[model samples]
Target: MMDYVWFIRWFGPSDIYSTQLGELAHRVVKKLYGLGNKKRDPRQIGRRLRRVEWAKRAFDRRGIHTKRRRQQAVANKDDSITTHYHIGKSNKKRLDLKTYTHSRDPAAKGFWTKLQDHILGRLMQHEFDGDTHETFTDDDRKHIRIKDRKLVELQTLRVNYTTYDIRRDQDTINPRNHADVMMLSPEDEPGAHPYWYARVLRIFRVQVISTHPLASTVLSGPQEMEILWVRWLGVEPGYHSGFQRGRLPKVGFVDEADPFAFGFLAPAHIIRGCHLMPSFSDGRTAGLLQTSEPTAARKTDEIDDWQFFYVGIFVDRDMFMRYFPGGGVGHTANQGFFQSTPDNAENEPRGEESGDEEDELESDSEMHQTTMPPSQAQAEQPFAIDSDESVDGESSHDSDESFDSDPEGDDDLNETDVDDWQWDDGYGSA
Candidate 1:
């Protein structure tokens, strides 16, 4: 029964053809047998019958299999390339940078930029300030000192690095070791602290002048920093956009004021390049997406090494319909559950009985008019009633015999009336 609905969608009219073909097979089998060989032994007959059954089964199965193969081939050939692809979840190979770089069918490019323009209300400013140096190439800037005895040793070559290396270097269980916090210092904070945190979705190592805003004006030396594009973590709770870290600490008098919504962007120091793990979550912390143990990620040791990056910008079919141009007006107008049907004058299709209703009413009224005599019809009219006279007595048509014959005349019986009181011959009170 469950498969009935599934089959209807997949096969459509195939069942009809199948039934017809089956009937033909049955007829052919019947004609070939005719009373089945009367001279054959019992064991021979049984074997022969089994062979026939096997042939029938094989025929049906082969037909079904061929039909299915043709359907699949047609689907593969005819499906449109322009259909909006859902990028929510995919295998590691699909999301990998190396695989993506080689493929002719590219994933949606400029997603981060478009998302920034749409949600953040401004584009990312391209400032040329040189403050970075390659540790492997330049001996003067091998290690960058961070806050609380933390230091970033830039030993990995940017050119040879894969997506896996970037993610492994950034993401971590310890909050201190997180890429976003690597450049942060206790003194820098309480002065000009970074309010938002983001995972480095992408990084560009192109040459650019990344000078310190204040120090550049005073001194002549210019430094460079690697340009990083990041997907911001949301400050608001319950938005399905980003992975949930723990709740922010209460900072003010209000005990329950939620953290500020933090996905908006401007020119800020990007001290992190990290992977966003796609997972389910509790209200506070990140959780596993799978309900069963040994997730697909954990099933293979290689999967654990593969990194992923995702922002909740991609829209599904339903979400696209909501914000689609000119569609919202009609959607809002017809938002209610009630649907208004157009008038019959507009030539909408009606049931057979529905159109006959007016004709039936008119015919019944004409029959009623003809059944009554002219005098009776006239007496029943509203103008026939006299204004000053009372007409309470019985009409001329009311006869004693006619009254006695009426079944409802029994309702007029009253033993308490003096005129109606009568005695039976044998009973005194009758």
Candidate 2:
């Protein structure tokens, strides 16, 4: 007889017990005839017990206990453990198994949904607003990444002609001057013309240390160039009477220097001597002469000859050495003369009077002529006069009767007297 407790210990539950009973029967021999007394030999029985123990040990080592396996088998025996739960809706309004599991897990659902919404929102905003997603264009991005790139490039640009000053010792060493060339046109003129007589009053050479856009390149360095002074000249009658005959009763130097300033010793004086007498002729007439064709032909008797002349003073080195023996820069014979008026000429020895001793010294030394070529000599011949008698006639007869009248006739002169006196006497008489 099987001990029930032993059977329960060996086999596990009712279901396993039935299966084990069947398997045990298959392996048992029928010779177990007299169950009580016909027991097998102790050694054989021991061997069988040992075999069962080894089998139990093997099963234990594999972590497969009959009780737990029975419980698992029973639990999974039917479809009862395989339960279903609803999740998010699918295309057909039915819950998808994978998505249902994911949706049921709140953590996973929140993460995925938030990420999806953010991506979709960004895409929509890009499409609707037409915003650029890239910071740089394709070409620009590649250009920035290139290893060899120039930091700056050279280019040509336009600039205006302008002027600047150079001064020393509180004195304008180089006074108002002009750039060599500038283009100008009158309001009505069709094209620009070069004004040649526009004097360059001073010049400088400077390096263009730096620049802003519109500055001229002509002044870009410490280099020399001429500048011009722009001003008008005032002509007064009787100022030029002694030099060019009374015919030039009016005169002016269009380009004049302040008598008080230390001007360019040579050029300034030349300009001062070349007095300009404005022609009463129309500017249109003068402009016609500048054109290619002339309106009139000259008679055989009419000569086209014209004369040009210039006069300039040159100071010899000896003169400069005598006055400035130490040989300093900017030595000028007329420098002292500029400090005082001509009326005070006797007040001081005008820059050390040229002495005979100095002349002798210069003669001993190699003397050199400092004067410019004689071709520049101005024709200064005295004005041609028919006679001294004509001069007297012009002067005496042309005098106003007022000069000869007594104090009694001052109020009696009428409009006729004024008209009669208008032809000529001297300045303002006509």
Candidate 3:
């Protein structure tokens, strides 16, 4: 009946009518009947129904949107001053900073030190209050406060972002499972790659309390701070990759000495979670960090990172849109980049939508227009914030979290329909 969707305009819109709709009412009425004495139960049911309606009306009048139904977390591009995100309805667990066994919790490895450095970063480094990358002096670090050490681990990160088509949408991100994340590249010339990529090692919330004179305004007392401990991956130094090349962006673990190899990040800095499939042919090696001194960032038993991974842009329409920028990945007034420069315009083919890509966009766009999934709607508002910052590990975040593979709802979005990032005989000039 999907083909009949065009008739919706002609016949007027209608909900799916079925016997189950009518039948479900009886289940509720029976439930109410069972709760009271059978005598005059019909009257009781009617009274209960009226009470429910009255309560709903009261809620509407007071604008009391319950948290359970407050699902429109995707703010529109025009309204969003800060990134909007949610964690769905999963329960969160907090852990103490120590196992009392000489800080041997591989997961929480470097938790205390990294977190302490993070406090210093927040106080000195982060771009808070219109400041750029500045750090506290040795004297300043002495005055910086660090109190609570408990870490709150979240299960999911529902990142609400604006679709390229100027509509709001979101992706559910989980560190244990859906761990890959993407953000706008800090690079100037993005002809090769336009976004930064990272594999989230863990998601945490820290309650920061500072008594330092420098942190009086920002850390007045105590505040809940959300951060992601991520291992940063870099685009292959000279690998020419993009859909324009009929290939995905080739990325790999950066050198251990790179400041961004690992870091803590403020949640708002992320654009959205991404799909990154391993470049199996390239193989994995423990040498990225070291096999001898296994990093706590990896699983307890593992000491390797995928030598390389391919950006799976074709995983979904939104993801495809993000890479195929001209496909409309939330660029208003041609601002957020999706076009090549005049030098590479012909080589890159600006705004050139291949027939197949165009068809996919049209089909997805049509589906979008026809089906109004209740989960998504024209959001009434987007997120706003005064200040946000990236706590790029500048130092390795290799110091934290016990690695437990929580494989809940692992997404098998990989489709063999797309070609893999093929093997290249050699590398280009560095």
Candidate 4:
């Protein structure tokens, strides 16, 4: 049937009457009339109809309900932290702007007062002369003035607007120094060997202006915060060291770490701590920091080769010495300035693959066995049986053997064909 598939396709079924032409014609007629709901196959039509109905139902649905949305809490009179400020949505919503809730900071009282006067003066272009004051009662005039002042303040300040002091401590290890190295956090790449190295570019402490989950935990002083900005050195196509083989780079690393060499940012918590390495002149030995130390202020070389210490993960002194016998795993000048440790010894290949392996040997032996002449197979097993033997094993005997001496006596045996002989169940002699 499979061999004749082309014939079946070329010359279809002989009987056209047996085909479902009638059903197809009926469907075509129904489609022309736009008669959807009728005697239809539910398996075929039900799903399509359901999808259409679903789309129709979803067409006019509204966006997220106000209750379901997470609303930000703004500063209020009831807020306990008077020192720290916050912003909340105001009652009046105009255009797309929500008026800023009034700040009760004691420090801003003078500023707010001056701002109010500046705003009111612009509105009251005309002087309120005695003639204007005489028309309204003193209480009414005062109330109007107060309301206008409040309105101006609200209009001037925007909701969600904030400001904070960026405190800089020159005492701490300055990240901008470029000498600072940090331990990378495991959370950066979860479910992996997360300890990595990065060079710090900047560090600063500031007051957090926005609400976030980590705000409370991260804030050290009153509204003050700290974070470390870093530039990550890539691990993919990573530099191998004396100890370890490189890992297949995770997609996250490849995607996030710009292969073309660009900078990326990570928070301070993601940085575990600072790591330091000793500088050496030879770029190999890890003796005292003195061997590399400037001894009599020697002239600097044109192509400076005195770069030995790098910002990276810290291994114990003993382990480092064991792995790197020369005290440092120096990089060839062409490669990047980083090194990697091997994963495991077992997974590393003992030697490169070649044609003379055990598998190749087995394959060669098989080919030799297969190509040998039939005469060799006969020589290997000359007495091999080709057919089944009878229960009495008579067929297995050599044909040249002599069996003319009959067990039964010659007088007792009658003339009969040996092939057609019929004997009693028990031997008559026995």
Candidate 5:
């Protein structure tokens, strides 16, 4: 079971008091038994145990603590924070607008302009009730002012979210480590998927000040705020991704030309980190953006993007619950946004292939409100796609805890096929 591994990281421990201490004690006793010879000298063993106990007592009297004990002390301090989530450590030196906007790194390109509009949007909706909040306009955004244009870049984000069992769990997201994330979607379309997926490109907390003449009543001073810069991902058109299919959902990066392709995200809206595997068989292509202009969306000088990626929903237990109907009790806020339930299976999740003649078919580019031309995309791949033979594999584990082919709780399957695979070919199950 991977439960012995990632599940522990996901939910912390089963309880404040755990059974590992007792098991470790037994292991120590077995080592002490080795001190006895073949004759099984009981008295000799007892004498050695007593001396060991004496040394332990003496060591404790000196007030020295083990690494585990010191870590627990720090964890206790973090538990006192009232919010379910909090930001963690980062670099000490802060970066200004000039450093970011003028940097040669592709990640920093156009960051200042996007951040300016983001601040204006937040300021416009500061204290409004219901749907009456003011929104950003072309004229309104230009008038917004920021204090000193200073920003603090963060390295880690610790998010504590409710699990499927109605318990709390935490996930740590880092831009370089665990960047993929999921968030609740507010859309109410029928047969719509419940969550929005994105990969965090950068993280920041800046002081926002609005100097718009029409918004003087909204603020008196600068307001400190936190936001995540993310590259939005969309589900593959006409892919069957559900528990019934036993295959993970496929998602891909939107065409870089799309306006909302990259935007600021509120950390408060994040659910947890997600695991996405590249669908190697689909191959890489440069048609998505097809631009030589410098972009923050992709790595420097990188001309191609992965054709598709699979959302590994089965990677962890909590992730599975998030997608299953009537399976997540804590996801009440998004109760109505899940895929079509059993009662209404006729309408599959948006972007899924349908056989009905009346239903309008959505092409890959049509899935997102993008102005990018479809003429540049793969003309061979039809809009009404069927399950690709590339994803041919079955879950070999028999038990619920046995999630994958590996029994040691490691994702050995995904790591397979890399040795003999060539860059020209796509990947399949190991």
Candidate 6:
């Protein structure tokens, strides 16, 4: 056999050949033991040996004489190639670092403050004059005039008034000459001309006692005041049929009823002492709360006639105070005429009694006409519906509780006696 001394020397246990020495040991042991031989040509084996030697020499030149160093050199080359390939393929670039920036101007904070001041200054000077800040009153002729004028503006539009008979207790489409009906008008109509328009604010059946003097009172008046149901018609284009009239321009005939006829049917008594004029607007017009004397005086007569004919409609303020007594007017902040009474007490009437004690007592007695007798009051009081005997029997059954005890003698025992009992008998026997 040819001497293979260099091959064995090269695969020896020195640091330079440690890995190859392990592989050679495996092959030699397998062959000697008759396990098998690795099938590799001499040329291929020489190529693998050359690669290992080159790695070992490179490691040694760097003062890395250990087996670990040689392996590390080979691994390092692989890592370097991977990192270079990734860098060459990618298009990533480093970004510039940034610092935060802030504004130091004082004017930014003051912008809104300046705007508010300007607006408030203009509002104070142009609108709320000193006298304008004073409280308004229903009794104030100026205020009433303004209210009437505004009402006239609202009433210029066409509206409908339907009559409901209290006597019949049902609605009648075609009202009889003297029959009553409910009426309605809108509070505000969108996109309409800003002028006096006809609106059926209320409807109540008032007896036509005399058309000549035009004198009449609310059918159920003073004591049992009737509620005049009002329907506010908004400003919209529409017509009023037979017994109906269009706008004021369409009122061609003498005493010809407008579509909304309550304004023409009103009797004098209801509106005699009351002020009727345009006092306020829906704020759609400039100077909404302003009062005009001439316009109000003229409209007073017109509205008075219209209101008298239209089932004697009253303004909200007048109606509230008249019917509701202490009910507050305009805004709830305004004090009401009536004060609340305690549960057990009666609400004393507000005005002074016109007659003597007997008359006052009679008035008080009249107020109780709708009240029931004391016997009825007692009967209405709540009490148990069942008999006293049945209640007593149920209570007795609930009170009984005496039949629940164990009969066994073993139920009670001293703690020491129980503890002395044997528990390990089965285990000990086993």
Best by lDDT: 5
Question: Residues 1-430, candidate 6, lDDT per residue (tens digit)?
Answer: 0112333453552346445456654553343334224455454555544554576567557765453333334434533431211001111221111100111211112222222222222223333121222233322211111111111011111111111111111111111111222221111233222112222232222111111112222342211111121112122233121111111111111121222211222211121121223222311221311233222112332222222221222333232232232222221211221233233322323224323665776664444332434554365323211111233433222332232111100011111111211111100000
Q: For model 3, what is the C-alpha lDDT against the true structure?
A: 0.56
Worst 10 residues of 2 by lDDT: 403-412
Comparing 3 and 5 on TM-score, the stronger one: 5
Candidate 5 lDDT by residue in tens digits, 7-100 = 5674576654566456655554565577678366667766766776665556568855443343335555756644655664343547776876
Off by over 4 Å in 2: 1-224, 229-244, 249-277, 281-430
Q: How far is candidate 1 from the true structure (C-alpha RMSD, Å)?
A: 34.1
Clash pairs for candidate 3:
75-382, 107-401, 107-402, 109-399, 164-328, 164-329, 164-330, 263-393
TM-score for each predicted model, relative to the true structure: 0.18, 0.14, 0.54, 0.22, 0.60, 0.16
Q: Report residue 372 deviation for candidate 5 (angstroms).
A: 60
Q: Summarize candidate 3's per-residue lDDT along 265-345 as a digit string, tens digits.
A: 666768888888889999998666754444545766666778999888787555765555444534422233456534543
**Reference-based TM-score, model 1:** 0.18
By summed lDDT, which 10 consecutive residues of candidate 4 come out lowest?
403-412
> Comparing candidate 4 with candidate 6, which one achieves the higher TM-score?
4
What does candidate 6 score on TM? Answer: 0.16
Ranking by TM-score: 5, 3, 4, 1, 6, 2
lDDT of each: 0.27, 0.24, 0.56, 0.29, 0.60, 0.24
Per-residue C-alpha lDDT of model 1 across residues 1-430, encoded as one tens digit per residue: 2233444664574446455456655554444355467555555555655665565457557753333234334433543333211111111211332222333321113232232232212112333211111121222112221122211212111111112111111112111122221122212222122123343322222112222332221243222332333333432332112101111211111011221111212223332222233432322221212123332112222222112223221222222222222222122212111122223323533324354676796675565455445786675543221212126732333322110110100011221112211112110111
Q: Count of backbone clashes for each model?
A: 13, 16, 8, 6, 1, 45
lDDT by residue (tens digit), candidate 4, 206-314: 2223222222222332232222333344343433332223222111111222321212222322322334453453353212112243211112322222223333333
Indicate whether candidate 1 or candidate 6 has the larger TM-score.
Answer: 1
Most TM-score-accurate candidate: 5
For model 2, residues 1-430, the per-residue Cα lDDT tens digits are: 1133333574564566345455544333232222225555555645654554576567668855454243324333421322111111112222222342244322122322222222222323333111122332333222111012111111111121111111111101112111111112122222111111222222211111112122222354422111122222233322221111212223222321232111111111111112122344411122211223221111234222111111111122222231221222332233232232344333434234345556685653322111212332232112111111233433232332121111100011111112211111111111
Scored against the true structure, residue 273 in model 2 reaches a CA lDDT of: 13
